[model samples]
Target: MSLILKDLTVSAGKRPLLEIPELVLPAAGFVGIIGPNGAGKSTLLKALAGVVSHGGTKTLDGAWPDAGRIAFLPQDFTVSAAMSVADCVLLGRREHLGWRVTGHDRAEVRRVLSMLDLTPLSDARMDRLSGGQQQRVLLAQRLLRDPRLLILDEPTSALDLHHQLEVLSLLKTLSGGMLVIAALHDLTLAGRFAEQLVLIEGGRVHATDSPERILTGGTLDPVYAIRCEVFRDRDSNPVVVAHPAQGARAGSLER
Candidate 1:
């Protein structure tokens, strides 16, 4: 399974959000989409997921994939306070279950809950869990569908450092089976986890390559407009350290 986009352009109202001349995503592995705010990173994922209208051709494995083959978890997910964690996660199985929840559905819900370490909170109200736990529950909900492509928009934004690592580790493990595309703000984390990286800016793809190739001073500084240093960690992976803009640094010094 592979996803290919040709001359893809997405518009919202009257403004274009994403424009990609050509891009290809391999079937199985984690692909990170990184960029500054308003860079259309999330919009690109939405286009691939078919959640938004776009002009161009998007194909899976040289042909159009099924409509529900892709599962998307948006950046801002509102958990209904009245629903229990188990019930919320169970929602993912709705397409398979039609209108009634069956015994198999309950078993699958338990399975996903256990997989996400949410079994203990299965009966808890959605409002009672912490931000990280809520995110996990939402993830479990998406996993219930066993999608071929999983599109996540800043899925770890509200998580603590520990939970962030936990979620990323889980994603890394699952990357072999699903085409995982995530919009990530943490450049270092993205470098460490993603097999491929796509940098977006001004509604276009600025660069696409391995993390070490794309997360460099030359590629990033031009887009971010700030000086940055790229280095390798002990394991020999790229890490980016950005410097404040000269004007911002001067302003701070005057204080």
Candidate 2:
């Protein structure tokens, strides 16, 4: 489940979106990709998932896994308007089924639906669900596949604080036997949950290490263009508190 990348580069037309000279991510842990907007965070995930065309090698354990072994949940996920929640989640089992779904696949679908508390909505149409509900349904769909490499982009964008914690907690538990990588906007949540953090800046990997080692103000101030402080909780985990950039604060003082 380990991932190794060498000379990886992604571009859109003439503009390069991501470049990583080398990176090795260990298997079986939650790795958080954190950066400001347009920092190529999403592109990095897409490259690893092979969602975008890129240069260089992205291999798992010295070879590539089949597409079915890797599951990707993009930031903007959409489904057909006519599909029910149960049918949508059941689709993840398509890779294993041959022309028809068996009882095992149906059981897995039911298990994940219950895990995500979607049993009540099993018959509901996906298009009519709330944003949070839809997000959970999509998550259940991905989880049912039991992918070896799970890639998620802004997975909790529409979830409330409660569901956010619930989903992260679930991923952490699920990562015991797989690699779960996500692009997260909340620095505090990323610091709190991810065992390893990959800091992307200007389409390059600025840092990759334990969250405690990289969440400091010195490491983040320039990338985010803000003045910030990093503290530790009772468990010694990093906690970030940010303020406006120094230049912005100075301008306000002058006024």
- Residues 127-221 of candidate 1 have per-residue lDDT tens digits of 87777789999999998988888899999998888878888888889888888899999998999999999999999999999997887777877
The lDDT for every candidate, in the order shown, is 0.86, 0.87
For candidate 1, which ten residues in a row score worst on lDDT?
246-255
Cα deviation of 200 in candidate 2 (Å)?
Answer: 0.5
Clashing pairs in 2: none
CA deviation > 4 Å runs, candidate 2: 247-255
- lDDT digits (tens) for residues 1-255 of candidate 2: 578999999998999888899999986689999999999999998888887899999887778878888889999976648789999998887767788778888888999999888899999999899988999999998888788999999999999999999999989888888989999999989988898999999999999999877887778888888877777778777778888896654211100
- Supply candidate 2's per-residue lDDT for 56: 92
Q: Pick the candidate with the highest lDDT.
A: 2
Cα deviation at 221, candidate 2, in Å, is 0.5
